[model samples]
Target: MSLLEVSDLRTYFYTEGGIVQAVDGVDFSVNAGETLGIVGESGAGKSVTVRSLLGLIDPPGTVVDGTITFDGQDLHSLTESELRREIRGSEISFVFQDPMSALNPVYTVGSQIAEVVEHHTDRTATEAWDRAVELLDDVGIPDAAVRADQYPHEFSGGMRQRVLIAMALSCNPKLIIADEPTTALDVTIQAQILDLFEEIQDRYNTGLIYVTHDLGVVREVCDRVAVMYLGEVVERGRYEDLFNDPKHPYTQMLMRSVVTPDRPVSSLDPIEGAMPSAVDPPSGCRFRTRCPVAIDDCSTIEPPDYAVTSDHAAACLLYDDDFAGDPPVLHERTTGGGRDE
Candidate 1:
């Protein structure tokens, strides 16, 4: 069984204008020691899904429907204090995008990491301090003994991220939710951080939810991937399967935009059109407005998820049986005229 399961979770914000669906009817599960990558354009609700899982969404934003169960316990049903005591940073830890902001300006890195260990575990202060240094070393921070005494402002962006990772690992949590953990780092630092994550997961046998807009990072670190669009999971499968045979138009367009060394720069095809606002997303398929192959029905009725293989599923009309005639051949349609009526 999976360690965490999110089913049809809807997180929305009630603004004066209308309800903004941040995370709409999303579903996925992460097995023990598995790394699940969530990839999409900005405003796709990747971060919202993770935030909602931890009950971190503010008052204006509410988890409207569905269940977020961690290890068979319903997270949405847990009491506020109970959740804080038992779940957050105890069973699950989050390493946010901005490490500089995540750490306190005045507290020593060792004090922060030590506090996490002391809070979650039955360890003495001296023992926790020793463990904190070990975690610093584990995350590849140099001079761990002395550096642990330094403040957040004393470290570089990459080092601060590493410190946050160390703090996250202090609890020995079952799951780690890393939200663009290497966002501000250079390529070399990005590689090193990713390597550290892999090593830690291997060492601890913990599940991971890696949320990012970077396709290259997803391909590199994730065992499986779920592509999100406008709060829904548009496509999901093994990393290799989705990358090799992407069925969703949105996923295909994203792949086209990626500029790899092997692919000529001229071959890169950027997907046009901007991501629609969550407050009033386009009807039917949320991606319809931006999809090059969007058909008339795509704007009227939502498509059912079609299984491409046992492990792969995509939410698109091209695979729907109810749609009349042969599935619209995308290769023949550029202006949406080749669709079967």
Candidate 2:
């Protein structure tokens, strides 16, 4: 069985304006030693979906439906106290986006990591401290023993991120949810952090759910990719297949926007129109308003995930054999003229 399986998950925010459907019927799974990249534009519900798995949704938001099974146990069945005691940190850890915000400025870096170890395991304080230093060293931090005693401000952005990673690995979790772990770091530091994640996953055989909008990072680290739009998974498949020949119009537009080495600067075509509001998204297919090949049925009948291959699926009406007119071609708009044929 998969290490983590999320089925028909729906998280909604009870806002003053209206109920914001942040995560609307999403489904995916992660296996041990595998890295699944959840890529989408902001407000696409990538972070919200992962948060729901751990029962981290706040007051305004609620996980209204669906099941989150982690390591064969249904997460929803566990009480808040039980989840905190047995599941969180001990089984499934999280490496948040910003270390500066996530880390306690008052406490030493080692103390924070040690706290988790002590809380989750029967380790003595001294043993937890020792383990903290060992974890820092494992994550490629220099002068681990000395640095562990230092505060968050003492370390650089990259070092701080490493510290957070070390803390996440403190209890030897089976699954690690890294929510944009490389955010705000320089390109060089980002590369280093990505490399560190690779090393950790390889060494520990931990399942990873990498949540990021950066397609470049996904290309470098992810084995499988899930593309989300308007809180729904528009396309999902092996990275190679999704990148090379995107089945969904949304995925195709996203790939066209990325600055790849092979694709020229002039070839970068941004998807026109903004994402529809999640509070009251477009009818039928959520992406129909922005889809280049959207047909009448796309606005009336919701298209289920169409199997393009054994493992590849796309939620687009065009994939249906009965789709009217010519098949939609992914084209790049040129500077001088119209879209390339």
Candidate 3:
């Protein structure tokens, strides 16, 4: 069985204007030692979906419907206290996007990690501190002992990110949810962080749900990819399948926009228009408004996850059995790892 399975996950915000459906009917899974990359444009509900898995939604927003199963246990069924004590940090953990914000300025990085280790395990304060240093070293922080004495401000952006990772690994979690952990770092640091994730998974056999907008990063680290649109998953399959021949129009557009070292940013084909607000999104297919190949049925009939291949599925009317004719496909551009419509 998969390490994590999320089904019909719907999280909504009760706003004065209207109910903002931040995460609506989302479903995906990841196995041990596997990496699942959730990729999409901003406002595609990638972060919200992962947060909902750990019951992290705050007031004015809540999970209205869904079952988040981690390691065969229903996370939704666990109470807040239960989740804090039993699930989070012990079985599952998160490496948030902004490390500086996630860490407390008052506490040293090692103390912060040690606190989590103590909270989740039966280790003594001294033992937890020692484990913290070991974790920092494990995550590639040099001179771990000296670094352990430093505060969050003393660390660089990359080092702070590594500290967050070390904290996540403190209890040896079965799954790690990294919400764009490398988004704020430079290319060199981003590559290093990606490599760290790969190395951690290889050594620990940990499952990972990596959320990001960069398909290039997805290509480098993800074993499977889920393409989210608005609050729904538009496409999901092996990374190669989605990049080489994207079945969904949204996925095709995304693949075509991949920025590589060879492909200059000026030559990138940008997708038109911005994502619609989650509060009262368009009826039928959520992506229909932006889909170039949208048909009349796309306006009235909400497309389901149609079978695309043995291991691939796309929520597009074009992939439905009732649809006629073949759909357009992506071709690898001359620029390595780039796709063209």
For candidate 1, write residues 25-81 as lDDT tens digits.
999989989999999988899999999998898978999988988999999998879
Worst 10 residues of 2 by lDDT: 332-341
lDDT of 3 by residue, 146-205 (tens): 999899999999999999999999999999999999999999999999999999999999
The runs of at least 3 residues in candidate 1 whose Cα sits more than 4 Å from the true structure, single-residue gaps closed, are 264-266, 324-341
TM-score of 2: 0.95
lDDT ranking of the models = 3, 2, 1
lDDT of 1 at 119: 85
Q: Against the true structure, candidate 1 has what lDDT?
A: 0.87
List candidate 2 stretches off by more than 4 Å. Answer: 331-341
Question: What Cα-based lDDT does every candidate model obtain?
Answer: 0.87, 0.90, 0.90
Clash number for each model? 0, 0, 0
